[model samples]
Target: MSLFNVFDISGTAMSAQSVRLNTTASNLSNANSVSSSIDQTYRARHPVFAAEMNRATANMDDKASVGVKVLGVVESDKPLTVEYNPNHPMADKDGYIYKPNVNVMEEMANMISASRSYQTNIQIADSAKKMLSRTLRLGQ
Candidate 1:
């Protein structure tokens, strides 16, 4: 792999982590939201990622590097939280209020992890840049 490829890989990883962070933030924002029905309640969303790769033909076998690819964002299928709150204005006719299935702690953790991953990618790109710079200096 070339030094330039490192930047591309890290850039794609950072983009993927950014999407993860955004989803985590969205989930956290809707964590306390209440609704009268389960369908109307917010659900935690997560981004799916896949490892992109390129394989050479049989005539000339060579491995090609591909960056990270985002599959899609998916909503959590877990059960929504149900609570009996007769006094709540948004309560259903049965005096039940529905809350999002999002877990605040879990979302927070995801945010932290995503942030760290992004930081790591930045560091990787920086290191690659430094290496390339030093290599150029070697010729001078």
Candidate 2:
């Protein structure tokens, strides 16, 4: 891998983390949303990630992983929260309201993790910049 590939890898990683953070934020924002029917209830959304690969050389045996790739966003399959709140304005004919499957604590943790990951990537890019600058200075 080339030394400059570091920036590409870290940049893609940061983009993936941004997607993660966005999905986490959307999940958190809809965490409290209620619906009168199961079909109308919101579900927690999560991002799917995969590693992007590149052909390092003409040699068939040589391959290099370039960076992170976002496969897609998917909704959690976990069951939604069902509450027996007949008094609630959104209650259905069965007097039950449906809440999103999003867990606030889990979403909060995801937010923190994504943020830290983004920050780490930024630090990595900064380090690479500093290294390149020092190399240029050495040539001066």
Candidate 3:
């Protein structure tokens, strides 16, 4: 892969991580939200990513450089939490309230991971820029 491709790779990685962070934030924001029914409760959402190989790299037998692509965001299939709260205004007729499936601890971990990934990608791009600048200086 060309040195310039590093920027593209890092850019895509940053974008993907941004989406991940956004989803994690959204999940955390709604973590405590309650609904009258399970169907109305918010489910934790996560971004799905896929590696996109450059067309030129397809035929190469060596390691292929790839960028990231967000396939989509998917809601967790895990069941929502059902709590018995007879006094709650949103409680159902059965004296139960449904909470979002989002887990605060898990969302915090995901946020940290996404932040680190974004930082790593920034470092990669910075290194690539430095290498490119030094290479150009050599010709002067």
Candidate 4:
């Protein structure tokens, strides 16, 4: 791969991480939302990613290489937690309030991971730029 390809790879990674962070933020924001019924409860969402292989080289012999691609966002399949609270305003007839399956600690951990990935990509791109500049200076 060409040295310039580093930028493309890192750029895609950064973009993917941005989407991840956005979804994590959304999940965290709705963590405390209450609903009277399961159907109305907010579900935690996560971004699905898939590696985008190079279409130009259809030959598998080329040693398949890929970049990041966001397949789509999917809701968590885990069951929602229901709490019996008769005093709750959103409680249903059964006196149970539905809460989102989102876990605050998990979301916080994901946020930190995404942030670190973004920073790493930025540093990679910055280093590539510096190296290219230094190479050009050698000709002067």
How close to the true structure is residue 11 of candidate 1, measured as C-alpha lDDT? 97
Provide the global lDDT of candidate 2 against the true structure: 0.90
TM-score of each: 0.93, 0.92, 0.93, 0.91
lDDT comparing candidate 4 with the true structure: 0.91
lDDT of 2 by residue, 14-87 (tens): 99999999999999999999999999999999999987644333333544536898999999999999999999
After TM-score superposition, the amount by which residue 133's alpha carbon in candidate 3 deviates from its true location, in angstroms, is 0.3
Which has the greatest lDDT? 3
Error in Å for residue 125 of model 3: 0.2
Spell out the clash pairs found in candidate 1.
none
Q: What is the C-alpha local distance difference test score of each model?
A: 0.90, 0.90, 0.92, 0.91
Query: Model 3 TM-score?
Result: 0.93
Runs with alpha carbons beyond 4 Å of true place in candidate 4: 54-65
What's the C-alpha lDDT at position 128 in model 3?
93
What's the candidate order when arranged by decreasing lDDT? 3, 4, 2, 1
Tens-place lDDT per residue, model 1, 1-140, is 78887898999999999999999989999999999988789998999998775322332344455778899999999999999999999999999999999989988899999999999999999999999999999988
Residue 60 in model 3: lDDT: 72
Q: What TM-score would candidate 2 get against the native? A: 0.92
Query: Candidate 3 on 26-75: residue-level lDDT in tens?
Result: 99999989899877889999999988855436847755568899999999
The Cα error of candidate 2 at residue 132, in Å, is 0.6
